[model samples]
Target: MNTDRKPALRLENIVKTFPGVRALDDVSFEVFPGEVHALMGENGAGKSTLMKVLGGIHQPDEGRIFVEEAEAVMTTPLHAKARGVMFIHQELSLAEELSVAENVYLGELPRKSLGRVDWATLYANTDEILKRLKVGFTARTRVGDLSIANQQMVEIARALTVDAKVVIFDEPTASLTDAEKVVLFEVIAGLQAEGVGIVYISHRMEEIFKITDRISVLRDGEYRGTLVTSETNEDEITQMMIGRSLDLSRRTARGEVGKTALRVEGLSCGSLFQDISFDVRQGEVVGFYGLVGAGRTEIAETLFGLRTPSAGKIFLKDEELRIHSPIEAIRHGISLVPESRKEQGLVLGMNCRDNITLPQVSDLVAGPFVSDGAEVAIFDQYRDRLEIKTPSWRSAVGNLSGGNQQKIVIGKWLAMRPDVLIVDEPTRGIDVGSKSEIHNLLRDLAGRGYAVIVISSEMPEVLHVSDRIVAMYQGRVMRIFDAEEVTEDSLIQAISGIENGKVA
Candidate 1:
């Protein structure tokens, strides 16, 4: 793979800083043509800052950027694009209200006779790119109407449209289903065949191993080391990224299962799910196992009052409840830590203090307004408990690392002191250490007499964390088994439509 080809992009001695934080310190790396260079780091490890500098969003205090063997300086995003550098951000950048074609060609639309856009050319070109990406939607489809997976494809198509040379993918597979991830890997393969230099940033170790040629680790704003993907193991990369090995063992049940904290009877949400029934005990973690489109998230959303159930009845302590909205659910002591943290969980513009106390605003309010002392006390308590590493509680949540941002979302719900907590994909794009921390936190929550529901696509996580597994397939409850009864292979088979009787 290494033909001594000139690196497509290289950085020499990069340095960047923010208020009170030396965000990047003398970082350096090179990504060659036809290579997938993974960028690995824990939260606050300067991964984002370095990428921003590469994308021309942040000007490095000191560094040399070379593009295609030529020294180059990216003064603006437009300049980077002109240099054939494309950055697909972790947070999507599509204009939701516009069509996929329009968003793809945004700010650089084709012109015809200086009067009108060349609509025919735009659609044709976009359609070709969509076909290449194996996207199931047309370019004429509105961006807002597309699912997160499809929206991501549109972003990829936009990067392709420019014929990019050096492409940066930031957590590109975070929201994708397994099937969708396969398609994305195919697209990446196609790009690689063209000798495109790729900077792939992902928290999923498996993805990094599967797709990357080499990995560059960053820790605390300093360059750690780079290793060939084939030569280094997960343990080595994880240690380099986090400065130590994390204890990833799943905690057992805190005590004997208490009374049933929540139960769902005949839960049906149209075609999303049907006749789903389950009971979660007070001191138990029930893991929902299913693939994409298997109605797991739908069931969680329905239970959290984000969606209306058609024929289901929910009981808390054997008492039926009519929860028509999220407010009602929260009022009834049920909370959901949603999958998409940035869009649904926390307001990025808000500070940790406000975000953590958002769910319990009513309780924190005295007379007419919120009591700052009360909010501060709650923030301080959970901040220490959760180990949210932030310079200040008032710093914007968006500025925090992905792990800390996720903690803020969890903190927001923990403040509610809910009897039932549902966490969906809690560690989606988090580092291994962060994932372990969040998993332990969930176990602790379940230990505290709260029924906890964990919905995850990760087989290892589900098998390790849950006392019971509810396997769903094609919108129906396939089977429910004790954690001891289902091995990883068996559970995966059950979730993939194999009968429980057939599974060992």
Candidate 2:
């Protein structure tokens, strides 16, 4: 809005290269003071790389970075923060055992006489920031005790601790509830009012359109173009980010519905979820839809033997089974691609081949040691089958993009040849192009007669990929609807614990 003002932060012709890849290539971007500039791209489009350059995590091979119209060299993260650049990363960098005050002023805590921490000053300052943000928790509260949303508030409060001219939010709302997101938007608005520039990175188009003033796109490490949010549309932005318009239509019914492959009757995991009942037939994809903390992931965990059901009956092919561990679940022909791939699904330090074959490593072993040939064969099979884009089988899973990493997780589970496959938030942080691919892959899996259960917070994803959707609210099933008959309004109402305008 302030066209005459100098940019709060600017990157000119930035180029960053890694082994076998140019992560960023001649990409230029600028964020004006008080502007919410959205950096849009598919998963591997170099947005993260560019942000790293700005955060001084990785130095750019070539480019100039200007802060407030002056060229500055950000040699380290400390230097970047000293230069008024702050990053609120997706995976929070807070020490859980520390209090909110301590986490906020982590590295630069105020000191009193004799090098002791000035506790009173720290708590007072943090309380003021918390009050300004209108957050519920106090500065004295331990960060580990707070919800994910409140923890993020601590991160935002940390940004305000310094004279931050620019704040970078990387997928800030990925784990937030709807009410939490509203509060976050309010905080962002307040920051804008204070003339602080924001660089927002997210895959959710709706959030981008709603909150951003300007949108700059990147495609395959190259700068595409920038557009004023008010003047552009999602289709145009999608084209700019992916080089093609996406098919936003729902998936048609694929594969004949057969006998029930998995059936859960009266499933209960204490207060996490209650009396949950569902059945996934052979060659069908059943989507579980809800907001965060609605027990979607908990239900998946329960099904995968990560949690014991207080009261429930699990049946595979109409045969009752007691599964007490993940290995037991796998032995019963059930595989779970967990919500957090980095934490639960794959070993980041391990190569792609090892990650894929890990679940079935025992079976792949020879007389004494593990067989590399067996592992590579399984990896190659799934790599080609899943179309994972890795440099090689030897490439570490951590080096791949979000979409590819997700595919590898799926590959890991798929190698077990499970009768029932549950993928939780299958395309959470992936870009539009990869999202489409994952959606299709789920359907294709169903077509191949592997019963699929998709647990998603994304409404469109559930509607697009599911044959039948189970909407949950506060750990209870609100309603079940055939995808063909489900309306957005109805689904929203169901997830909100309302049916036909009354509380469900």
Candidate 3:
């Protein structure tokens, strides 16, 4: 808490560039020992780029890293490791089929003079590390059998094995439950007490304010500013992250929701969801709210035909529509911008133009060939409308920022011209500016009379964007509230099985 604490790690005038983008432009940051320093920015604001440079995943074009007031060389993960720097990423990299012991001792398993593996020592070491991190799962359990929260704990345990002095956590709680998050926070606090400097990267404002001692903001590969956590507020941090203040009140009230465009009656997928029914009226935005693993995604998948509803009926207007596959759903004027956009939504190797036309390209094709001109006109329209930041339509989507990639997904769905559109966590990893853009686009679509269904874990987002909000718990609709009538407390209460001052 002292202002005079010395920085354990310092990045001086760091510069990194990709093919068409300068990922980091003279960005500088410092982290003090025994303190939690949060790296704040929206997606593509260069937070991750700076972290990668420090972790030795990406070599900077120009910069100098200093550890303990001495210049350090971080050319590779090994080099970083040797300097007591370790990185734990959002996506875990543990082998599921392997036992915890095997994963912990991965390539450097203990051995005897006879050249035989020492399984006993490996398990013992794994157990010791897991205990030190306070992880509960057994060392013999398969990683695949563990929950996402526990898998993340295993990741932390792995880092502790090396006795790292500086640790970097990138979006560590993106998929963790509240209870799991508490455990992770406890471990981090413990590390801080041990004088281990931590760099925390996250999109959640609450987490940063709660955990960090100092905060740094990066925008478009440039260092914006750094502030003490006690001296800054969320709005200030958000403004710095996006280069402007965001008007969170831009979503206007749509006059009247019309007749139902899509209806789910007694929808049940047995273990996934049961007796779930909701009606999405034209010109209305409805949100499905729940905690992770609360069946929100399963319901969306069922509606999109990724999973067959064990028992239910889907009505598109007056006629019952049987959705057996995604193709059938598309034919019935339904399109879904799935969660995990990078993995399931867009083809990584393909260009933006190609992805936009993927859902409905037949209209742009001549007798037996695709019409490049037609595709260009269509892609250009949405790209411009969505304000996607990219070099060209020919640019590979994989090369774009996470926000741009999400815009591409939305553009792809728009190309389909669906009567009902489903977007899961539409702004999951986007920055404030991009989040506002995407939210406004969805509002515009609803204003144009498209039935929009948004599923999100962020409570404020649901309250901000929905015309009607449906709270789901244990795969069933717990309660429904008009957006205007819903407060954050009420919404959380419904989702958590509390209502009217008692358990529902």
Candidate 4:
């Protein structure tokens, strides 16, 4: 609304499609010079599709793009760059083996008159760019050795190398810690000061409120609305994004703690965790809350037989059990939906249907060959149950977005019909609607008498879904609160060891 400011880029009536799905339809928005405009939407809500169109990764079937009020055609990434548009992808794309300086100046490296690589000029120039962004890592260091946060900083530095005027960042803070997020905010502010128009995309509400000046929402491949960040609350934006008021209130009145389904006595995995103990009963959801390295995941891995407990006993239904591998755990009706969905949960090369039936494919098969009809029928049930958004079961699992891939993982585990289901970060990188569906699915599992163990860093999720919460600190069971006694404030005090600090 500032008359003094000129618009840097504008997208008018963009339309794009692939196969049977129209990924983007008549979407329009504008980015002003030196301002942060956020693109907010559900996973398949046309946000990614619009960005790809802008970056020339995909040409729009219909629409117009303008730069500085002049019509422009961007048919390739280089063309977009020529108009001063740079895009940082959500998936980290730095060459791990290359040095930070080398990556910063990768394609457009400074060269001598004889056409030789100018290492000295590259390092000197990259160092200045890194310093301007306040990145502490040495430019000469290999990017693979740096943390995820630092690696992202290197990617941003590469953008500066291009002399980019309009920068688009997708899910920039998805992996950053709280301290790292602060550093990123400072960097973004610095870029804005330099008159770079920035388009930021993320699902974290607090982040959008903090870093964005204007917010745009897209739903089902169409532009929903745009709002000024100063006048909006999370509920208002969420309503526009999801097209309804969200019942985020998740405190359930659990009937009673039924018979014990899982019992771990004196569980230990050497130095990872020592003398851990817990009990999970039927129709109960128990949450494990901890920091990154507090050994919460290690405990889940041990229980699922990914790691062997140095000394402990696991009992299911009052019968002692021995779990030496994931297969054995599955056979004993214990399943794990691991944290890293791509690396551990689903096979990217396979289709959604195959990924769902991977665990118990043999059971669905007849003779020595897999029954194609039986496989399709079995997968269709889960695909429908999980509300997976795919044109067909034949769609490659890798092609689906993060939330859809997560549903496939959940479908795979649910097909196993496990007595105890352990899920780690169930809603990470997913949208509000998908998150609600997943939560309902977990509750349904618990209602059907399955013992569910959820591990999450989001306090709202833990407090909402769990019948009883277990707070893990320094690899020990620091505190446990029943459903009736747990509140957001109390849970924070228990997990952080700070009772008087501000939680709300």
Candidate 5:
């Protein structure tokens, strides 16, 4: 593990602060050559702030950064990259319209006489990197046409373009499938073999244990102790991050199932999905489980009137309806919590109160003027109900943590008092504690007679909260099993399009 070598990158006594918040406080961290160090923390634990300090995005109030035994002042992102520090962020920054090679060599494209781009050299260099990564796509392939997993490979290729001594990966596998994760692990291993240090940040414990050598924890901007990966366990790490051990057990309390609240018949959305039929009863949680691109999100969008179905029948309380828009869906007593909270769910520039009352702004008007009293009342109701941790109702939604931002989205939808609620990827980037809270919140909502449909890619989440599970594969329902009757192996097989070792 190169224990005798000097650290590839090191930060000492780092402190960063905003106007009203101290994001980082006296934090110290180091990554050795050829080692994978995991930065563990719950959302808003100062992990992002610390990374920003390292990336030169935000200058630390007090700190020192050293690269290979020499002090380095990273004044900008380009300076950080020049010092052999590269970051592959969670949300990729690649130019989607450009080719893989162009995206890889974005700023530093090879130039010929008179500043004309040297396309031949650029493609040749990018092809060598792609071949080394063993990816299937070519250098000339358009990045927008590639899958999410392959696009991530392009991000990694960009890192390799420089003489990177350290690479930071922030939740790289959040959108990848099980098979794709294996490929990512192989790539990380190859980097480790070449003596490149890696700083891995993710909330998934399984991946941390499988890929990391050391785990350093943070809580509320303070540095916790670091533990060797082999010597520490998930329980210990959970305690370090959140100050308490988590309950990793499944949901045991079941809500009483009543009459069907929502039913879909022969729902077809072109090539997205075909002949999909499912029903969610009152006071019950129905989980939809599938791999990425398995048409789960597409079905939810169809039901929410974001997309028009080619052919289908939607019934709410046994009455057929044709929903043409999101407003129509909301009027029909159906609400959707979209997958990407930043993109479709919340208005980042708006305050918490405004975001929560946005859908019902017209109703909130007293007489030709929106009532601030009504907006604050609704925001306060859901803020306490959802346990959203914000400084105030006037705080910008974008300043909150990922978990809190997600709760605001849910609270916004909950204000509508819909008969049926659809939540997609409820805990995609949330920490362990917040994930448990959100899971329990879904169950509590169901017990309160709100029909819930949870669409998740994580198998444990689907199994933990669902009363009945619908497994889909390649745009078709493979099977539906009662929570008590489903086995992990059987569920995996169903989602993989295999039943009893044969294609379903």
Candidate 6:
């Protein structure tokens, strides 16, 4: 794809600092036109900070930016927009309260010569862009009512509307499905045909090798290296990102598995999932594998007492549980690491120490006063355990990256020392290093005689981490397999609902 053309965007000697952290230091990279360049790195390795500097959200203390062959000073997002630089963030920027057309042309709405809003022109233009992407959505659709995939497509349409020269996609497929991802790839191909330079940031290795033409690795705010995609392997790129290769192999329990820690019989929660029965034993890990709407999350929520089961029985140590709230579940030594950490897990306005200790406030109480020293001591403990990278315990949870925030969520529940731990998509947005750490930690917890249940959409993750695999489809249990008996193909078939020659 290299055509001897100058890079569409270039950053030279870029340096940015945040208080005590040097987010980026002399990090330089180039993105050529018609090329898909992947930015690879672990969390807190300066990938997001570097992208922010390019998008004009953060000014570099020292560096130069070049658009094509000329220098450009991007002091604000609007200035970058004028230079044809667009960013599609993982967390979408669309206003959920507005219609699709309204969000598309929010600031630069079409106006008639009579100083009135041109409603017809706005919807027409939005429709044209949607059709161009081959996406099935109307301009009048409210963003709040749309799925995550549709919302992503609308974000892409906005970039194309601005005629973006250098477009950056940050973890774009974190919430997309296989079918939706295919459409996204097609759209990217269209952009490539138009000679648009793309900077893609994702933790998915398969996506990198499938779509990227070249790859660049960043670590600790410095440029590590760049490799041609065709000549590189996942191991090599992963090493460059983390300074070492990570191994997430099939693991066995260190000690003998114990008795049933938790059991569910005839668990039915309305139409979400029905007749679900499973058991988690001490020193064992159970993995629930399914697609987005396949009811895995609903199952986990019910176990955590966030959802009321209509007809079912939950037993802990063979004793029936009448749980009606999260407080009760935690009181019975059950805790859930929720799926959406930003929304369901942590309180963003609060500091890291407080969020980690929020669920265990009772543990830190001293009669009429909640102890600050207790919170700080607990914070120090988890900070060391999780390797959470922040200036201090006083730092707001809102300011940390997604990966770090997830660690705080995990730490919050771990502090409870629950007998049964249910983690829903525990490593959703975490980096490879953090993921490996969490994976090992889970295994350790089980080895220490705690029950662990992991629910994930990633096939390899489930296959590698779980002692047993529980496959589900359309809110029904398909089958369960021991770790050694499951293969990726069989798992995919089960997840896709193609069992016993019948597709459910």
Candidate of highest TM-score:
2
Whole-model lDDT, model 5: 0.92
Local distance difference test values of all predictions, in order: 0.88, 0.91, 0.86, 0.86, 0.92, 0.89
- Per-model TM values vs. the true structure: 0.96, 0.97, 0.94, 0.93, 0.96, 0.96
Candidate 6's TM-score: 0.96
Sorted by TM-score (best first), the order is 2, 6, 5, 1, 3, 4
Cand. 5 TM to true fold: 0.96
Over 243-270, each residue of candidate 2 has an lDDT whose tens digit, in order, gives 8888788754555989999998999999
* Model 6 pairs whose backbones collide: none
Error of 4 at 119 (Å): 1.9
Q: Each candidate: RMSD to true structure?
A: 1.9, 1.4, 2.1, 2.7, 1.7, 1.6
Error of 5 at 124 (Å): 1.5
lDDT of each residue in 1-504, candidate 6, tens digit only = 884888999999999998888999899999999999999998889998898888989999999999996898889877898899998888788999999999888788899998888999999999998888777789999999998788988888888778788999999888887778888899889898899999999988889999999999999899999999999998898889887888867644335699999999999999999999999999999999988788999988888888999898999999999898899999999999998898799999999999999987987889899999999999999898878878899999998977789889888998998989999998887778878887888887888899999999888788768999999998988888888678778878888899987897
Task: Give the Å shift of residue 175 in candidate 3.
Answer: 1.7
Q: What is the lDDT of residue 449 in candidate 3?
A: 92
Q: For this target, which candidate reaches the highest lDDT against the unseen true structure?
A: 5
**Per-residue lDDT of candidate 5, residues 31-78 (tens digit):** 999999999899999987888788878899999999888898888878
Whole-model lDDT for model 6 versus the true structure?
A: 0.89
Off by over 4 Å in 2: 252-254
Please, what are the lDDT tens digits per residue for candidate 1 over residues 1-504? 584988999999999987788999999989999999999999778887898899888899998999998988988888899998999988888899999999998988888996699999999989998998888899899999999888988888888888788999999998787888999899889899999999999898899999999999999999999999999999899999877887655434446689999999999989999999999999899999898889999999898898999997999999999888999999888999998898899899999899999877877788898999998999999899899988778989988887889999988888888899999998888888788888888878877888999999888788768889899998888889787677767777888888846632
2 or 4, which is superior by lDDT?
Answer: 2
What TM-score number comes out for model 1?
Answer: 0.96
Put down candidate 4 lDDT per residue, 377-398, tens digits, no spaces.
Answer: 8789988887888878998999
| Deviation from native of the Cα of residue 173 in model 2, angstroms | 0.8
Which portions of model 4 miss their true places by more than 4 Å? 1-4, 131-136, 498-504
